[model samples]
Target: MKKPLKFPDFKDEDKAADWLDKTDFSDHLEPSDLKKINLPNLKSTKRLISLRVEESLVEKAKQKAVKLHIPYQTLMRQVLHRGLEAI
Candidate 1:
């Protein structure tokens, strides 16, 4: 089996993203090395911002958050995280 390259230890997310921009995942990752990460206690350091979002969209997000049993802000963060991963 081909040895998987270890992902570099980054000081912060920006550095990790910079590395990702320069590296191809196929060269560094293997299916067997993939593992589920659950950060139930993780707290993100967030910056306060005023964002203009559609009222209907906000209501839909609140409904989804209620269904998922998470805070609406937490649900929004999850969605944003997934969107960032797609880039």
Candidate 2:
């Protein structure tokens, strides 16, 4: 197994930025060391269309979206995308 990356505790944002500024990410992210992670809310280069659904359903989704800290539309898209992939 590869060693986990260790980062130092910074005094503030500037110190953290300074360290990151000098560091070479290639040294850390070699192709063999790379791992895939799902990036939620990644904006797609696509046009939007008008989509209509039941208001009650939208309200319920909005309530859940608020707890997850994402817009209802983004949450819906994520759910729909996953559903599509499951087929």
Candidate 3:
């Protein structure tokens, strides 16, 4: 039987990447160590764009966002989503 491999300590990200690139951990890892991940659909992801709105409106949204414990941008998205649903 092949001996189980031990993970090496790296000083920084570049070393870690170098080690990862060269080493195969399949022999050392158990089935339980693997996890299934679902990546988001790139087509449906949000795109950043420039939108101009009144400063007072942004301040109101910021105040509301603080009260709801969420980022103002998130609050804006929620509001926009609701408005779109109403249309």
Candidate 4:
């Protein structure tokens, strides 16, 4: 039987972060790791379109993105894609 993996427990957030920073796994990743990962391709080949939203809407989108810990542009793209699919 294989022994269960045991992970070290850190007492504090700083200790945990420091442990992660000190650990090196360069050998585990290949050249492909250095390349940008592409998202699953959407069949739509339509040209990109830009839309102007109200200042308040933009601020709200930014705030939501920040709260969710994601880039505002990424959140906007997700919202747009879902909206298009719904229509």
Which candidate comes out best when scored by TM-score? 3
lDDT of 4: 0.66
Candidate 1 yields a Cα-based lDDT of 0.75
Error of 1 at 66 (Å): 0.4
lDDT of 3 by residue, 2-87 (tens): 45666566555445555778887777667667656443322334679899999999999999999999999989987996699799
lDDT of 2: 0.72
lDDT of each: 0.75, 0.72, 0.75, 0.66
Better of 2 and 4 by lDDT: 2
Off by over 4 Å in 1: 1-44
Worst 10 residues of 2 by lDDT: 37-46
Tens-digit lDDT track for model 1 on 1-87?
355666666655545655768887676568776778543433545679888999998999999999999999888977987799999
Residue lDDT tens for model 2, 15-43 = 56557787877645656776675434334
| Poorly placed runs, candidate 4 (over 4 Å) | 1-49
Q: Which stretches of candidate 3 lie over 4 Å from their true place?
A: 1-44
Each prediction's RMSD to truth: 7.2, 13.6, 14.2, 14.2
Q: Write the per-residue lDDT of candidate 4 for residues 10-66, one digit (tens) a residue.
A: 555445545667766454455454546333332344457788899999999999999
Weakest ten-residue segment in model 3 by summed lDDT: 37-46
> Residue-pair clashes per candidate, as listed?
0, 0, 0, 0
**On a 0 to 1 TM-score scale, where does candidate 1 land against the true structure?**
0.50
